[model samples]
Target: MQAPSMWRHTLTFFPQFLAALKERAESDSTVTVIGASDGRLVVPLVAAGYRVIAIERDPIALHGGEVQLPGDRTGHAMGLIDRLKREGFYDRVQVVEDDFLETGPATTRCDAVWTSCSWHYSANHHQPLSEFVNRMQRLVRPGGLFGAEFMMPITQRHHMLEHYTSPERLRQYFIGDWDVLLTLRTNEFSEQAHVGQLQDHTHRMGLLLAARASTPS
Candidate 1:
């Protein structure tokens, strides 16, 4: 199948997470994507035959609207809803237009849940990092997969907040019934600006993939 145009690309670890999901989850599994901006990851999962619960808060990200681009440019965003429809994967996704932390747990437990560089945003800093993570963890049922690639501290402000975390720091949450499968971190890298950020920026990122033990440990 042809790939849908996405507003943003996914994290480096996404393919690994997808492979892990395929290996660990049923083909018809339900996958929840937190901060599902314009179907970057959602489209791939649905195209691969997994049902998606896409939770995002920004209206412009959900419905088509004008947006700011790199190098101080302006452009139009086709948005997640339109992208899903264009890809013929609309029926396979459930769009939740709300803040993930505020929305709390999804009504149903998902077979897998993923988030990419979402929690470090200043808008999300009001909540504790533990709250954001705990809620995401609770959304996955036993034997489910949990994947997250997040921004590690780069700027001074980022270092001030626990949300800008490292794989080592994040691993503390995966103990007990959750088995951490992988942990990777990137050296500081430069990315051209887009959307929320307008100038070229450098960032360090971390990835964590864990699976919930099927039975109590």
Candidate 2:
């Protein structure tokens, strides 16, 4: 619910989180990034030497396109991609402007899949989560890893909490299929004020670094 303004601050600590996660990933790994809104997370992955396929639905956020920063939601996605390209990381990433749900998995295979703060956009949370998990399974080889950061109870509305999942529910959804690693709950405050006060909200996130189950021998 916190607007794009809040994202700036949240992203500041992202590098630390990524650094920790990076230790678990192999160098030059192939990672498919879904729902990569503005490439906030994808750029870091690229800089870390991971090959990425970034998927997004916003037209202005296509790979290699120019984007306005801070709050121009339209171009932010593309902007990040362009920045990465300028920095020589584009060689490690492929930018695609398409609905991830519509994009089939036959063209690009990956070693892992990473997503951040975008799943709440799904029309049906359960269905999308299932499809997303299945897609990750397809994109990564058997026993490969899947990682994501999701907003729990997604919303900034004072009276209304939107379609979000708690850490437990998220685990319930994937428990049998993947091994859970970490789940965290945290709070973020935004400059946007509601009724003359800055909007502060809590988000429960499931940071799952799980590996796909091995095929039966």
Candidate 3:
């Protein structure tokens, strides 16, 4: 597929993901947008009236352990929250400046959990696949939804193998513990982009949606 069509198909996954989420969440339900970069899903969830947890490594990435100066920043002071306030959803969202995987399961379970193209950071850092998958199972209450988009490697260069995850490997993480609801994959595209250019290669991205089963007596 050409890059443009691939991009269009790639963008469509979010709404499909959200629609699936709607079937599982109420307007007032609590939603957790893990790795909330630039408030993409966070703002929308808050605007739609679900309280959201906008978690990230920090409100903004720092330089050499120091905060970036105002002029050097590409985003706002409070990251997602700052954007939320401007959009009038400030009071509905909370920001957590910590690693999502390291933060582990939330103390308070939410109605739904979401992430867009962010889980690989934790994987590359050596977080076990089951830990994140099981953590999602724990963070979303029974009957709640968990959704995420991740780029899975069909093949990788020898040096790049350490940081890639395969689709098969990901499925093994959820096999028996949960009920899979939706599984979708997009055409492979050069996984890298630079200044409006795509390299001559590609990788497959898969979407996984599942529900936490109710506890049996």
Largest lDDT belongs to which candidate?
1
Better of 2 and 3 by lDDT: 3
Segments in model 2 whose C-alpha atoms lie over 4 Å from true places: 1-6, 11-21, 63-78, 122-127, 154-163, 187-204, 214-217
Tens digits of per-residue lDDT, candidate 1, 1-84, equal 533344354246798899999999999999999999878889899989999999999888789788777776777777899888
Writing each residue's lDDT as its tens digit, candidate 3 over 1-217 gives 1111112223425676678877777889998877776565676677677898877774342111223322334322334555565688778878777877777446798988887766555343567556666666678887788888776666545226433454455666665546778888877665433211233346677787877676632
lDDT of all predictions, in order shown? 0.87, 0.60, 0.64
What's model 2's TM-score?
0.71
Q: Sort the predicted structures by lDDT, highest score first.
A: 1, 3, 2
Number of the top-ranking candidate, with TM-score as the measure = 1
lDDT string for model 2 (34-106, tens) is 7765666777787777788887776544534444443333332335466565667767777877776677655
Which order, best to worst by TM-score? 1, 3, 2
Looking at model 3, report the run of 10 residues with the lowest lDDT sum. Answer: 1-10
Q: Report the CA-based lDDT of candidate 3 relative to the real structure.
A: 0.64
Which clashing pairs does model 1 show? none
